[model samples]
Structure formats: structure tokens, C-alpha cells
Target: MIAIIADDLTGANDTGVQYKKNGYSTTVKIMNDNDVSSSMFKTSDVVVINTDTRPLSKKDAYDCVFKLAEKLNSVNNLEYIYKKVDSLMRGNPAPELEAILDSTDAEIAIVASAFPDNGRIVTDGTLLMPDNKHVDITNIFNTETKRKAVNVRLINVREGAESLKQYMEGQMENGADIFVFDTVSNEDLATISDAAMLIGKKKIFCGSAGLAKQLGRKKKAEQKYDGTVFIVVGSRNAATAHQVRMATETFKLPVVLVNSEEIIDGRYEKAVSESVEKAKEYYLNGNKVVIIAIDSLFEEYTVVLRATATENAKSLKVAESLGDIVKRLYEHIKPVTFVATGGDTAFQICNFLGSDGMELVDEIVPGVPIGILREGMADGSSMVTKSGGFGDEDTLVKVINYLMVNRK
Candidate 1:
């Protein structure tokens, strides 16, 4: 079994889908502060555990990865382990990589955080822009936060992994933790993978989705569909609310703003049924996208916030209610694509559908990826899970248009 330690749920699914597409039965666990149970995972193959530690401090991130790697190592048949960092290098990856190396038997840590498809590349051991501009990897880490003292060095991929490994060993003699590997294209990815596989000694790998995608990738069957796309707003953000309003008014999409007050007042079942039926009314009449947002129907979001004692509790209830609505909608018509905003909301819907981890195929906007449901509902159904705070105005329009254009 292979264990992947990811920093977030979306990153977990994106990397796990790489293995799943290549014929490995992979499952992604939204890990938290809980007991790591064998029954909670698919023991026969790959398991990607999401630590959800992007927002955590360096020390906390390190502890989380160290504990998770230690707990998962108890399971036999461990093929390999990798730390899935943010492709754009947003999280506390340095410490997490260090933690994995500290806890596991891995001696060398090789990192490749570039995906050329997304225009991220590594040139001369530093991240490069699509336009060949060098990105100062140190700037993001050095000034943003206080990081642990480790050997922050890189290896030129042109020299090959054998040389890189030798460099790592030399640095290890000096107490080095990890070495960032250079990769400019798919060929570079293959070279790195080949080098890692040939290494006689055990080592940890630290990389982004690009490396994972290349390690075990297979072509998916062509999407076969002419279907509607459902957009469910499960997170509260002023930007998303603006985009939702834009899409509804400009595209004339039907809006089904769920009443959060009713949901909080012991009226969930009826609220879900009514919302689904109303959305279906427009959906059956040929509308492609239906907006399901809470509090927008009866009151503004600020009013809802003022009424609720705990904002998180309200969001959780609304997320579940929206999930119930989507589950009911699936009974009537399976959407070609489902856009679920917010992490908890997406997780709830995915758990309800009994889906295997997501297979990331494309992206609608920056930091927002669209992936296929590996197991649940239909074979080609696509899902877009976005955090509530990301994306700009017209982001929803761009998302829906992208879905419509690619709704195969």
C-alpha cells in the first residue's frame, strides 16, 4: 500500500486520482485529530490521507505529518510514501517534508513542484514562469513565515538524479533535510521518477501534483454526455456571492436560495425537499446551472451571521442540507458537472455519494481544479470543489462556460 500525505482535501484528491487513473484503487481520507483505523481505509492499495494543515504553523504541520506517517507505517506492504505539497507552493511544505523524512525510513528527500501543463516549471533549480522568468523560491518561504533550519538547496535536473542523490548525501552529511529537483517538462518528470526508482536506499519524495500525475498516469476514456451543470454554493464569501449574482442575472440561471433560518429551526427535511423541487422545475425546463445558496433567499448573509451564534455550525448545517438537495437531484437527473464550493460542503456531498477520490482532469480558474468522480454516480461526472474565499468576479461565469464547453 502507498500512503500520500497531503496538505488539503483538494490536493489529496488531485494526487490520489493520479494513482486511481493508472488502475490503482485509491481512497482519500479527510484526516483529522482522530485514531487512524485500518477499517477506515482500503488496505489493498493506495491511500491518500489529507492532513488539512495548510493554514497551520510550521511546527504544527511537521507534527501532523510526522504522526500520520508514523501511524500509517504500521500497515505492511507499504509501496512508497510521498508528501503532496501545494502545486503553487502555498502551504508549509518544507517542514512537512522534513517531518516525513524524520518519521519514516526515507533517507533522501527529492522534490519537484512544477507542472508545465499549468505553466509552472523548474529551470536552473529555481521555479520558472511560462515566460522564462525565474521565481525566487526562497522569497515565498523566507519572508512569509518563520521556517525551521534545513538545507534549502536545489539540484539541476540536467545533471540527473544520480548526481542529485550524491548531492543529497553530501548535504545529508551536513544535516540537510531535502533537495528540490529541477523539472521543466514531462521528460524531466520521467527522468526524476526513473532516478528515484533506481536508488538503492529508501528516500522520501516531496512534490506537487505534476510529479504525482506523471508517476502513475493513464488516459481516461472520452467524456460521453450532453447534460446540464449544477452549481451549488455551499460557502459564504463576498466574492462568490457577487459571482453568483452575476451568473444568475447575466445567464438567467434559476436561483434556489435555501433558507438557513428554517434549516436551523428544526426544519431541514422539508426545506431540502422544497429547494430540490423548485430547482428541478427550472432544471427540467432546460436551464443548465442552478444556484443553491443559503440565506440569499430569505435574508442577506450578514443578517444570517448576526442571527447565528456560531458561524461554523450554521455553515455545516447548510452544507449538509445542500448535500441532501444534490442527492435528491441525482435521483431525478445526474448533472454532467457539479460545482461545490467550500471544503466541508464538498466533502459531505462526496461522502454521501460514496465516491472514490477525485481524478483531476482540468481547472476552471487558478487554484480551482475540475476532477472526475472516480467511483460514484456516473463514470464521467465531473466535480469542481472550490474554497469559499478564492476566485474573482465572473469566476462562476468562467466556470460554467468552461463546463458547458467541455461537457462531453
Candidate 2:
């Protein structure tokens, strides 16, 4: 009788699948904002949390875990402990849980994966960050001095474009040579040719979503950007990130992994702002800026703003804040193309642009809607009346992948 808590549907499914495969009697629940009763706690022996059963904020997730623990501990003082699984592992642990576990005396185990030898967590844990240090993209870039030539493929849209802009700036500051391909059409060969002309080196190529799949089909060492370092940003562990990694490896491209979970850590708002500012600075310093956002999800904070707003006044206030940020950002660096990701972001952007509503043309990314804004909407009219299909971790992955690979 093992309890498995998931933060989302995908995590719940994945964890349930793994436990079933391992011959464990597991019950995976997609957690909502609620308390777990003591009776629910008495049913399981080994609980696996896939970071899905809770919200995005670490504080919220930690609070939920604490509540769960309190409810469970009352029934049976089960030896409470925290466990971390790797990106390659079947169970994906939430970062917030890792933080909560760090604060407790409960036994922590890093089962199967290599644990950080000198990390804050002791050796008793199975998996650890390399060298016991939190992995940072900034540190990775600074460690290498020789300029590496890389090609970046941006899908192009609005949502998390600022993060990519910031990452590109960071790479340029670290003296890495970068080439960007603004392709929303999934034309990999064309993008490769464009990248060849821009940078003239074929060492690395970074892309996301459909772009990664396009690259995956090519013969290894056959394209203009052969033996490239491939990076994919702004997707989930199962979806874009995993696919891109496989494609890069299959095509014999050198790969450096950067997930969104790794980018902001606990300070999401600050990270987003910092990334946007960095991109602006890079553009001002005379570097070419190529931002690729597949859709409106690139500007997720805007979506969050819309989601947080229940009333028209609240929505207007949030939209006004977003408008200010966008205006300031555009003043510094105007992206060549603003690609919108999901329908919600597109609607919000269109609303911001004084459109009525967007038309649903296609679902660009699976489980995400892509649409065009309707004509003749009044200015300041709220388009995103209610928010749906927003996955914080998935969105974070998408943002980070774009930044890490596209960084100059």
C-alpha cells in the first residue's frame, strides 16, 4: 500500500506506470489544493511523488507536503523521508519537494541515480547534482573560454521569448559565437543553411518542439551544421526536451542540457525580469538578436496575470502591468517575429492589441491550442476571461530550452 502523489496528470500517469512495472501496489493521485485525510495515509508503504500533485510555487508545494505529512504522521509515525529521482529516472520529483526535504531530518535517498558527492544532502541519497553543486547555466558557460560556434532555431512567438533573449546575451558575454534561425515553419534544412551562412561554423545547433523532430530525421554529419551542439528549450521532460536530446544524440550532435526547472530556481519573477533585461542589453551592445517563441506561452507571466485576475478590473490591472513590461522591453529590442504559442496567450496578446477574440486554426503543440485573434475588439477588453491548460513545469522547460541553446 504505497501512496504516490503527483502534481500533474502526466506525472501521475508516469509514476503509476513505473510503480506498476516494478510490481508495487501504488496509488497515484493528482493532488489538488486540499488536505489528505489520515485514512488515505494508512494505505501505503512506499510513496512516490512526481511533483505533479501540487502547484508551482515551492511554498505551496511544501505546505501541501507538510499537510500530507502531518495527516499521515498522526495515523502512523512512518519513517518520513524524501527521495529524488533523476531526469532519466521513471519518477520526476518536483524541485520544491527537494527544497522541503532539505529542511527536514527525514531520511533522503537518491535511489538509482548518482547523488552529488558534496551537496547539501548527505551521501545516503542515491542521486545528487554533479560535484554536490546546484547546476547553473551561467557557471557552465563561464567555465569554457574558447568560443564555440552554435546554431539556434527559434520557433518564434511571444511567451518566453525574453528568456531566450537573456540566454543569448549571456552566451555572447561569455564569448560564444552564435547563429540564430528564425523559422516557425519547421524547415530544418533551410534553417541549417541560414545558420551556416550566419556563423560559418557547424559545431552546435539548438531548437525546440517541431524543430527538434525535423533535425532528428537527418543523417548524422550530413547537414551544413554537422557535429553540432544541439539544445532544446521550453518543453516538458517527456515532450520536447526528451525528443530534442534523442534527436541530437541520434544525429551525432554534442549536447548540453538546460531545463527551465534549472533556470529560475526559487525566484521565478526575478529570473524572468533579469532574463529580459539581459537580452535587451545584448541587443544594445550590437549583437544580433533572434527570438523564437512558438506561441503566446512565451509570455507566460502575461497568462498568469490573466489567470490571477477574476474580475474585469483585476484583468485590466494585470494586463496594464504586462503592457508596461512589453512596452519597455520592445523599446530596448524589437524581436523580428513574435510567434504565439497557446490560444490563451494569443488571446491575451490580441486583446492587448485591441482584438476581439482569436480563431482556433490548429493545435501547434499537442494539448495546446493555436488560434488567431478576431477582428474589431475594443482596447483594454479582456480576452482571457479564464485560464486553462497552464502547466508551470512544462512552461518552465520550454522557456529554459530556448535560452540555453540560443544563447550566443
Candidate 3:
């Protein structure tokens, strides 16, 4: 089995979905070092552990990763270890990578933080963002420890896997502990993967979903899930709002707009019951999808309502209220598929449903991950999660289509 260590839940699912799309049974454990069980590694071909260390200090992140890596390296069936870093290099990747290298038998680390589809590319050792801004490689490893790294330019990568392997070997001999490859496209990532395969397993791979897609093992199998999908959109991001609007308007799906004020006023039970009734009516009426979203998330009235509550209470009340709606829907209709927009909304829904984590399956779009609830009342139920600000207007439409095609 292959193991992936990630800093966040979305990163874990997005990377794990690469293997799942290749027909591997993959599970993402939102677990800590101590909560980790043997069953996580034994039950799936690929397991992704969400260490959730992005917000942690370098020392804390390093210690967490080192201990986990040390324990995982001893797993008899562990084939490979992939360190999943943020595509935009937002986290303490350098320390986490170093920790893995220190704890495992890996002598060198191959680093590639480019996801071209997401408009992130490493060019001449600098990261190019979607907005065309540039970030230097050195700035990413901003910790006190200055690690030695070399960038395999685009020209070197295009020269073929053998040529790249020879260049990497030369650098390894010259005391470079990390090789960061410059990639402008998916083809470049594939070339890097070939080189890594040729070089052997004494090295650890650290990258985003881009590299994971190329390195993942594909077994070609079929997975079929059935039922209409329930979408809960709690993000105030304009992008998500537009997508939801497009999907509901174009497809003529029923939408229930949550009264944020009612929820905050402690009428969540009434809100949940009313929303469930509407959702159940739509389901019985033969609608393939139902959307539950906050009433006018982009409107000024909603903003004012949010501001009226304390910062912490605002998020807590809204997230819990949305979670309650999802829970009630589950109890009322038993919908096998659910889609959640916004990270807090997703986490709260899982919490309310008694889930420890999710079993990742596939992606509806580039960064939109689809998985199944794990170890809860909603266990084995399909779920799709999207970052509020990620995806285009048609992303929800694509999700709807994907569910229709893959549903049992």
C-alpha cells in the first residue's frame, strides 16, 4: 500500500483522488499521530493522512511529520511515501519534507510543487501563480535552517527521463539534498515521474496533486454509486455563488435558501425541519439534485447579519446550523450523495454525522474532490467537497453530470 502525508483535508482528498481515479481504494484519515490505527493502512490500497499542520509552527510541524514518518516507514506493506504539499506552497513544506527524509531511509528528496492545471508552475526555481505573480523557491523554506536545493530547468526535464536522471544523480553527488523541477505543463510532471521511477525508491517525493497523478498506480476498475445528490453551500465566495446559481437555474433544480437570521436566533430546529421538508418534496417530485444555500450570501443584509454576531460565534452558529440541516436531510431522505462547499461547512457536516474522516474516490473538477463518509452514520455515502473560491461557473454543472454518469 502507498501512503500520503498531507497538511490539510482538501489537499489529502485532492491528492488521494488521483489514486482512486486509477481504481485504487483510497481513504483519507483526518487523524493525528496517536489516533492512527492499523486498520487505516490495512483497509485500503492508498491511505492519506491529514496531519493538518499548515497553521503550525515549523518545529511543531517537523516533529509531527517525523514521528508519523518514522512509524509509517516500518509498515511492512508500505510501498511509497508521498508528501502532499500545497500547490501554491502555502504551508511549512520544507520542514515537513526534511522531517520525512530524516525519519525514513530516503537519502534524497525530489520536490515538484507545480500544478499547471491550477495555473501554478515552477519556472527557473520560482513559482508562478495564477495571477502571473512570482514567488522565489528560497522564500518557501523561510525557516532558520537553510537547506540546499537545485532546480532542474524545463530544458533539462524536456531532455528525456534518462537525461534528467543523470543530471539528478550528478546533483546528488554534489551535496544537493533536494531537487526542485521546473514544470510548465502536465507533460513535464510526467517526465519527472519517469525519471523518479528510473532513479529508484531511495528518495521521497514531495509535490502537489500534479505529481501524484503521474506517479499513482492505475488498476482500471469500475465503481458505481447511486442516488440524487444534496448540495449545501455555505461559502460566501462569489465564485461558488455563481456556480450554484448557474446549476440551479440551468438544470431547474430546487433550492432552499437558509435564513441566517433565523439560525442565529436559535430557530435552527425549525429551519432544519422546513428545509428538510422542501428537500424531501423535491426528491419525491423526481428532482435529481437539491441545493441548500444561505440566503443571499453575497448580499449586504447577510453581511450585516454576520457582523452582528461575534467573530467566533458567527462562524460557529452558521456552520452548526448548516450541519444540522444536512443531518436532518440525511435522517429524512437518506440521500446517498452529498456535496459541500466551504471547508467549515464540510467539517461541521462530518462532525454532526459522526464521521472520523472520508474515503476519497474521485474529483468532479480539478480541485473539487469526491469521497465517501467514513466511520459514521453516513458511512459509505458519497460526498463532494469544493473550496469556496475554487472552480469556474460551470463547475457545479460538471458535478451534476459526473454524479448522473457514475450513480448506480
Candidate 4:
């Protein structure tokens, strides 16, 4: 039985769902005494525990994971453990990694966070994404303002597993706790996975959802949605705004604008009632892709003016309203493909639609992923997600084209 440990609810859901998609009955446990249902253990082949310790201090976080690791270690059927970290390298990975290392016989922890499909790659010990940039390791974890800088070493995968082992041993001698493995593609990830599994001593795996997907690849359902696709655009970024415009003008995709400002005024419920019906009409009238955006012109400008910390809460309300619109339309139309852009908006929609987690099947674009949910919808209903600033002007139209030409 595989066990996945995550820092947040969404991370647990998304990573665990990947295993579920691959035919393992998976459960995302809330990790509370009264909440961990016994039936979940009986039904799931994999049990994912959400520690919910990302926001905690280093000591607290370490203690939380240590306790959980101890509990899992007691389980007779528990196999190797997977420590899930954020894809963007957010949150504290070292403390939790240390807990896993201390609890298990695992001599080394493999830290591979390269999700090439999501356009994030680690090459030569530096994160190579957003234009071949490496993380600023020197200042990242130095919370104490006056602490001396810690030097980190990057070992290339081309150096082979022996070289990696020697380098890790050297790092251990020098007191380095974590190491990042470089990967440029899916093949590279598979190679790394194989090498880690072949380690002489026991090992613990640490990475984002990408590495988990690679390690747990199996024959599962193929998710394809060539039918009506609904595109939900909630990003106020100019890049997304331009993409929305290009998609409608270049592809003639139907557009339905929701008054997001109304949400801030406590009128979101009133707005969704109309948007959902219009979306239904638009889809039924022979439009293959329907673009649901906020009043783009207003969003384009107000988003700039609302750039203060005080206004962020209000901005979230607008995001929530946009999510509600998408949820209503999705349930009403049951569109084959659900495309949601912007992180907050996408999370809200997934929450409403009960997309506890999804199995990643394809990349609509680099860093823009399309996948099938493990539950809460039709088997093949494809769900696509994108960051607010991920793509270019023609990205949206190109996604629709990909869906059209590559039907399963």
C-alpha cells in the first residue's frame, strides 16, 4: 500500500487522485482522529495523509510530520512513503523531509520536482523555468536575517547513479540535508525514478505531483473530451485578457461576460442565474467552445487600481463569483471539457464541482494541464487548468484546436 503525505488539502487530493486514476483505490485522509473513516482504509489501495502543516513554523511542522510518519510506520500494510511538496518550491520541504528520514530506514531522500509537462524543470541543480532560472537558495530559507549563507551543490543526472550517491554522501558529510535532482523531460523523470528505487539502502521520495505521477504510472482510463468545451477565464492579468480577446476574435468562440463587480456588492447569486442559462443556450446553438469571462474591459483596468493589500480580499470575492458561474454552468450543461484559468478561480471551481483530485492525462500547453477527475463527474470529462499568466494571446484558441484535432 502506497502512502502519500502532503502539506495542504489540495496537494493531497491532487497527488492521491493520480494514483487513483492509475487503478489504485486512493483516499485523501484529513488526518484527524474522528475524521479518518475506517471504510477509507478498507477501500483504498493508497492512503494519502494531509498533514496541513505548511503554514506552521519549522519545529511545529517537523513535529507534525514526525508523528504522522510514526503512525504510518506502525501500519503493517504500509509500503514506501511519498512526501509531496509544492511544484513551485513553496512551503518548508526540509523539516518534513527530515521527519521522513528520521522515521524510516531510508538513508537518502530523492528531491525531484521537475514537472516538464508543466514547464518546470530542474537542470544542473537549478530550477529551469520562467526562462531558465534557478531558485535563490542562498536567501530562501535564511529566515534569521544575520545567519551565514549556506552553499548548495547541484549534481547532474548525466553523472549516473554512482556519481549521485557519492555526491549525496559528500553532502551528508558537509551537513547538507536536501538535494534537487535535474530532469528535462518525462524520460529523464522516469530514469531518476528508476535510479532512486534502485538505491542500495531504503529511500524516501520527495517531489511535486509530477514525480508522483511518473512513479505511479500504470494502465488507466484514457480521458478525452472532443465535444463541447467550456472555457472559464477569471484572471485579471493583461496576458490572460489578451488571450481571451484573441480566442474570441480569432476562433469566434462565444463569449458570456459575468459582472464580477456585482460579487463585491453581494450580488453574485443574482448574476449566476442569468450566466448559466445563457451558457446553456450558447452551447446548444452549435458553438463548440464557449468563453466565460468577466466584463473584460472593467477587469483589465480595475485590477490595476485594486493592487493594494487591502483590496486583495475584494479581488478574491470576484474570483469566487467567477467560480460560482463556472460551477453552475458545468452542472447544467455537463460540458465534455472544463477549462478554468487562474489559480484561485480554478481551486474554487474544483471545490464546488467536488474535483477532490484529478488524474493528469495530457498537457493542453506547457504548464497548462488538462486531466480527468477521479470522481464527481463523467469518466472522460476533461478538466484543464492554467495559471493567470501562463500563456500567449492565441493560447486559448490553440487549446480548442488541440481538443478538436486530438479526440480520443
Candidate 5:
């Protein structure tokens, strides 16, 4: 059985869903679950454990993963273990990685957290965001523990699996505990995965969903939407704002921006009704893609001037209002697919649509996972969920085009 160990619940779910999409009998279990036995591993092809250690102290995180890794290493049916880190290097990664190394027979951990489809890549051992902003990997991890890392440059990775394997073996011989690879695409991650397999039991894979997806590829084949692609952007992220602008101005998609300020103040009924009407009009007028997004213009001003008590309260209310609009839109027209950006927005919309969960399918891009509503009015309908800060300016256009191309 394949194992994925993640920091939190969402991280575990997303990674486990990748294996599920690839036709694996996947199960995501909490780390403290009593039934995480060999029988559970025997029945499933992949088992993901959520350690819930992101907010813990470094020592606590290490202890948590260490105990879990020890139990996993004791299991005989285990094929390989994947340590899932955040793409952005959030939480206590360094300590958790070290704990895995300490517990398992694996001598070196290979780290490649690049999800190029979401515009996150590693260059020269540095993590780069979608906007091409450089993020230092070492600094993001807990400063309490020092991470000893060796860089496997893109040049080395491009030289094929054998060469990459040889370099990693040499690094291991030289006392390198962790190997951080430079990757700018999914193919690069595949290469790294190949090299790790070539190295065999002496090593463990450590990365984000990008590397985990490559591991899933070994189990199954490489792998959409229809009708009007309804998009809801409730993110205040600047990256999403640029994407919305690109979709409207460049792709000529129609967008109706809702008054977020009014939504938070509970006076958004009129605005929500108008937005819904405009969205339906766009769909009926031969527009394949229609968007209902929270107005970004009022985000900053409203947060500072409004008496919402806290930004969290304001965000929740806005999400609720957006969900209400989407719920009402379903009354008029049933779009072939639903695209939701922002976690809160997506959750609220799904809750409003009567869905408790999303069935794992495939990704429109690397990080942007497309699923189906598990139990709702839109049950079995195509749905895509994206992080607010993920993707480029043309990301939404790519998503729409992907849905169009894959429509059945």
C-alpha cells in the first residue's frame, strides 16, 4: 500500500484524492485513528494520514510524525511513504522531515514541492510563487531546527533517471540527509520520482502534491466540463484579481462583480438578485463562461471602514452572500460545470448547494483539482476548486478552455 503523510486535513484530502482519481482504493485517516491497522492497509491501495501538526511546535511536530512513521515502517504491505509538504512551505516541514528520516530506514529524503500547473516552481533550490516572486525555502521552515539540504539542479535532473540517481547516491554517500531538486514542470517532478524509485528503499519522497501526483501516475493512466462554466471568484488575492481581469478583458468573458461591502452589511439582497440576473442573461445570450465574483475594489476600504469587528467575520458574511447568489442561480440555469476560487468561497457554495463533499476526479491544471459534488442538488456535476493565490493571469481562461475541450 502507498502511504501519504500530511500536516493537516485539507492537505491529506487533496493528496489522497489524487490517488483516488488514479483508480486507487484510497483512504484518508486521521493520525490518531484507532483502526489504522495492517488490515486497513491491506484493503486499500493508498492510505493518507493527517498528522495535524502544522500549528504545533517544532519538537511536538517531530514527535508526532516520528511516532506515526515508526508505526508505518513496521507495516509489511507498505510500498513507499510520501511526506506531503505544502507547496508554499508552510508549517513545520523541517522537523517533520527529520522525524521521518529518523524513524524510517530511508537514508535520504528527496524534496521537490513544485506544482508548475499552479505556477509554483523551484529554481536553484528556491521556491517561486506564481508571480515569479522568490521564496527562501530554509526560512519558511521552523528556525528551531536547521535543515541540511543538497541541491539537485535542473541540469542534473534533465540528464535522465540514471544520471539523477547516480548524483543522489553520491550525495547520500557524502552525508546529505535531504536532496532538494529544482523543478519547473510536472515532467521535472516525474523525472525526480523516477530517480527516487531507481534509488529504491534507501530513500523517501518528500514534496507537495506535485510529487505525490507523479507517484500516483505510476499506479494509473494520465487523465473535464460542459454546458456553461460558472465561475465564482471570492478571493481578495491580487493574483486572482489579475486572472479575473484577464478572463474578462482578454477572453471577453462576462463577469458580474458583487458588492462585498453590502454583502457583509446584510443589505445585499438587491445586489445578489441583480448579479444573478446578469449572470443568467450572459449564459442565455450565448456566453459559454460567466463569472460572479466579489468586488475587489471594496475589500480594503470595507475592511478598514466597516464595523464588522474582524476581517474573518466580514469574509464569512461575503462567502455566505456569494453562496446565496449561487444557490439562487441554480434555480434559473444549471451550468455544466462549477468553478470556485478560494477555500471559504468554495466550501460555502458547496454547503449552499447541499454538497457535503466533492468526489475526486482530475485536475484542470496541477494544483487546480476538478471534482464532482458528492451529495447535493448538483450531485455528479463537474466542479473545480482553486486556491485564491494559485495560477497566473490566464489561469481562469485555461480552466475554461480545459473544460470546453474535455466537455462530453
Candidate 6:
């Protein structure tokens, strides 16, 4: 039996569904009560706890995990345990839990988000890579453009920051000019307008459908940006992309609408291959390339692979095969820089490069987790992998902007 606990029903459901699909008889329980007994824990072979709802202080979180581990210890049948804390900033006790784990001989895996306010020690989480069978697009760039400083901005919406980071890094050998600004309300839009005035360049605003609609209503004459590209990328339905495209066109911006499904489709390998061909042409034509991908992971690719593969042996085989493919591809492209998002993607890429497995390095800002692989340190060959994760779409865009401006 596996017990998964979360602060809210949504997080529990998401994590539970994954475990269930992985052939485990899982039970998802909301963590409302403070007291859990060994007898209660003995019923499950594995236990998962969500630490988001509890107070985030190191001592508080440590107490909760310590008690839970004590309860699991009483149940000799417990083989594996996982604890998930949703937010790092909202009083997560990850540091205390790590310290306690170091001292104890507990068989447990802990995963947590390191929101900006949280300290470094508590931010580290286990990295899980996808199976080898899946194909991933690392750094994808288009033709070189004459523009020296490209301004990439995202409206403060859902999951945009992380998505934008992947897309921008994919498009250029080096990261593009990126900026993160809030556009959730009128005040954010005004702030963006003020910033645009200070740094005048070609500004591309990326956002979901809802944010694009809000911007449409504002119609602030001063908010117009030169060479503005509105990228409509989100996990929502196709309707959202269409709506954003329409709104951006109303402003007469050079909008390039991208369908999230098209980019993230299982056929990503093929789509990216074609995109790369186009990029080569653009590069040959002397245009600086800027590529942006948003909201790529709606459904976990791991679940999809597990469902498609006939057996666990086949799943592992496919994952290994994918590693080989990525290894060969990296050798060929030799990109100057690479950026990735999410634990699974980072792990898979690192494995492909035959690097010292995947490790959570640091949090670039709040809600964004960065994973790094040192240059020339992998087993097979040296490959560079720079990736980060944002919990939602809005943050995805923020990361893209941050990278665009800061890319060295």
C-alpha cells in the first residue's frame, strides 16, 4: 500500500494519479491532522506526505516529518516513502527534514518546491528523469536576426515564465534578451509601460489567452512596443491560443501564435527536427533567431511512456535508447548554451549526456528550480545542461525574460 498526503486535494490527486499509474495501490490523504500513529502508517508499503499546508518553519516541518517517520518505522512493511511540500516560501520545513534524514536510517524520498523566501538547504528536491524512449529537444535556435538586444517579456499570468525560458533558450545558442514583468492587472501593465520607456528595443510580450485579452482592453497608447511578438502558448484549449492571436492582431503587433499541443505532442522529435531545418535556413539568411515555447508539460510524459510501453523492461530499454539518441545529437549540434525545465526533462537530458546524474543546484528566483550539469564531466562525453522549473505558466515567462536579459 502507498499513502500520499498533500495539503490540498488537487496536489494529492496529481501525485496520487502518477503513483497509481506506476502500478502501486496508492491512497491519497489530505494532511489535516497533526498526529499520525505507527499502526495507521503500517497499513501502507509506501507513504507520501504534502508539507504545503503545515507551517514552513524548519522546526515545525522537521517535527512533522520526524513524527511521520517514527510512525512509518513502526510498520516494518514500509519499503518506500515520499513526502511532498507544495511551496517552499510558505513555511516549508525541508531544511529540518533533511537534517533529520541525514541522522536517521530512514528509507524515504522527499520532494519540495523552493519558493524564493525559503533558505537554500530546504530547496533541494529529488530529481526524477523520464524513461529513455522519449525524444527531447535541447537547445533549439532559428536563423540569426540583426537585432542585437532582443527584449522577451511575459505577462504575469499562469505558467508563462518557465515555458518562455525553454522556448527562448531553444531558439538561440546563447539565451536571448529576456525580462519578466507583471501584467495581471492594470498596475502591472503600467509598470511594464514605464520599463519599456526606459529600455527601448524590440519588445515581445508572451502570455496566455486571458492575459492577452486584458491587455487588449487596456489599449494604452503608450504601451505599444516595437516589433512586438505576441506568443499565445498555454496548456488551455486551442481556443485560448486563437483568442490571444486575435487580441494581439487587433494591436497590429507582429504576433507569432504557437500551439502548445503542437510543440508538446509526442511527435516533438519530428516537429523539432523540422523547426531546426527552418532555423538553419534562417541562420544562413543572416537573421538572429528567437524561439519561445510555453506550457509544454500539461500531462506528464512519464505517465504517457509507462502507459504506452508493454513492460517495465521495455520502458527502461526505451529510456536508454533515448539517451543514446540525445548523446549523438548533442555531439552534432554542439550548442553554446542549453536550458531545460522540470525535474524529469533535466534528468533525462543529463542521463543522455552521461553526466554525474541530475542534481538540484539552486533556485534562480522564487518558484523556479535550476539544475546544472558541469561542462565536460559526463561519463560518455561532456555536455552542458542548464534547466529550470516554474510551477505554472506565468512563472515560465518570467524565467524566459530573466534569461534573455542575463544570458552570458
TM-score of 4: 0.70
lDDT of each residue in 1-408, candidate 4, tens digit only: 877888765566556656755667676555554433334467667877777665566678888888778766666666678998766665567678777777766665677776676577665456644534457533442332122223323334556656656656666677554556667777766666766665565667888767777756564544556777888877776668888888888887788888776777788778777778788899889887898877753353322311444565775676677667766776667646878776556656666766555555555555565666555544446777676555667788888887887775
Model-by-model lDDT, in order?
0.68, 0.32, 0.80, 0.66, 0.74, 0.33
Instruction: Please give, for residues 1-408, the per-residue lDDT of candidate 5 as tens digits.
Output: 888888854466567667776778676555654545687676568877777676567788899899888888878868778898877776777889888888888777788988776667888888865455566664444243454577789999999999999998887777676788899988898899888888755666888777777765443323345677888988777777878888888778888889877777777788788888888888889988888898872243211111223765777788888888888888777756878886567767777988755555565665676766756787777777776667777888888787877866
- Per-prediction TM-score to the true structure, in the order listed: 0.66, 0.28, 0.83, 0.70, 0.70, 0.31
Off by over 4 Å in 6: 1-329, 332-335, 358-362, 375-389
Candidate maximizing TM-score: 3
Collision count of model 2: 44
Global lDDT for candidate 5?
0.74
Residue 67 deviation, candidate 5, in Å? Answer: 9.3
Q: Give the candidate number with the greatest lDDT.
A: 3
TM-score, candidate 6, is 0.31
Kindly list the per-residue Cα lDDT of model 1 for residues 186-219, writing each as its tens digit: 7777677777777677767677767877676574
User: Whose TM-score is higher: candidate 4's or candidate 6's?
Assistant: 4
lDDT of 2 at 221: 14
Per-residue lDDT tens digits of candidate 6, residues 185-221? 3333334334433332323322111111122122111
Q: Name the lDDT value of residue 127 in candidate 6.
A: 17
| Model 2: CA > 4 A from native | 32-35, 41-55, 75-95, 98-105, 111-408
Model 3 misses residue 38 by how many Å? 5.3
**Candidate 2 residue 27 C-alpha distance from true site, Å:** 2.1
TM-score of 1: 0.66
Global lDDT of model 4: 0.66
The lDDT-based order of candidates, best leading, equals: 3, 5, 1, 4, 6, 2
